[model samples]
Target: MELGKIERLLDRYDEGETSIAEEKLLREYFLSEDVPEHLRSYQLMFRFSASQAEEKLENKPKVVSKRNWYSWTSIAAILIVALGIFFYNDSSRMLNDNGLGTISDEELALQKTKETLHMVAQIMNEGKSDLVYLKEFNNTKNKIIQID
Candidate 1:
């Protein structure tokens, strides 16, 4: 191979314009034992590339069958549907058994609401009475701070 041609290819390679065939020619030239001293520095790189290309993978690719995947997916779907139906029927049965499916009269519901509110108000008033102790404690702490 002509040194001029190799120099031209090198320039093109550096410019990212060299074709695969040109690159192969350059690699072969650099890998040869008679590589010129000026081009000897590039020999190591080409030798490394050649060695890498010749390397064989130790582990073969694993082949997976998708047939079992479809079956498993279908089984999972069936189980989901079965569980959903079971839960729905159970919930409906519980609601019906507990008489929650029936509607109460508006007047009765209003009476119950008023009773619940009265109880809540009574509880809140009791809680407010307890807060009186908290107010006394706060006053005592403030007086102690002033003394310090």
Candidate 2:
């Protein structure tokens, strides 16, 4: 009978031996209200599976925020390089008229070196005097704080 064929199809379907046509027949039979009481569970299962197949994906395409920081950074780098080249060319063109790149006069260089050393020594002596004041301040702080 038709019921025996349906039972055989169900067994074949469960064993993964049913074709698409067989599955469609099974679906059609289970979806009908005339399904037997004994096979109600299969009908519910098929109905739920059918409903799941009808569901549409709720995934809406999201608009991601794009950043052009690389473009801006490249523009800034190009401007910096352009400015550097311009300044380098300008400075090279404007060399001092006095062909005095290096102090060719040894005596003048020695005099200049001595003057610079004297100025540095004077500043260092001033710093040493300030250190004396700092030591006095530290002594006064220790006395006021009473940290024996």
Candidate 3:
């Protein structure tokens, strides 16, 4: 092909106006060893493009599928649930043989109740004393400001 035609094709190719056939022609021209010195850079580029187009992926891609993770997680979740159920059942099955059984004694129960009530009454009296101080402060504030 004429250098002028090749140059015009290149110009159209740059402007994105050339058809695929015109681009193939440009590639063929550039691939030839007789490419003009000025167009040698384009030759190198077209040669690289050709070589890359011929290249292929030799190995299949290593796809990390979520299936493995999901399977493992499900297995782990099942194992955890099984272990929890086993422990719960086993603990319940074990007898309360370690001095932890309940014994009923009316007198002892009555004494415990009385002591609990006495402590509750003491706590209530302490809280009530704090309430008396708050009431005195409110009364003094009412005397000074008369907030109705």
Largest lDDT belongs to which candidate?
A: 2
Query: Would you list the rank order by lDDT, best first?
Result: 2, 3, 1
Q: Candidate 2: global Cα-lDDT?
A: 0.89
Runs in model 3 deviating more than 4 A are: 69-148
True lDDT of residue 18, candidate 1: 91
Residue pairs in clash, model 2: none
- Judged by TM-score, which candidate is best? 1
Q: Write one digit per residue (lDDT tens) for candidate 2, span 1-148.
A: 2999999999998899999999999999999999998889999999999999999879988755345767788899999999998877566566777775578789999999999999999999988987888899999999989966
Candidate 3 lDDT tens digits, 42-132: 8999999999999998999999789998999999999999998887756555666664644378898788889989999999999988998
Q: Model 1 lDDT vs. the true structure?
A: 0.87
Task: List the candidates' TM-scores in order.
Answer: 0.52, 0.40, 0.46
Give the per-residue Cα lDDT of candidate 3 at 100. Answer: 62
The TM-score measured for candidate 3 stands at 0.46
Clashes of 2: 0
lDDT of 2 at 83: 92
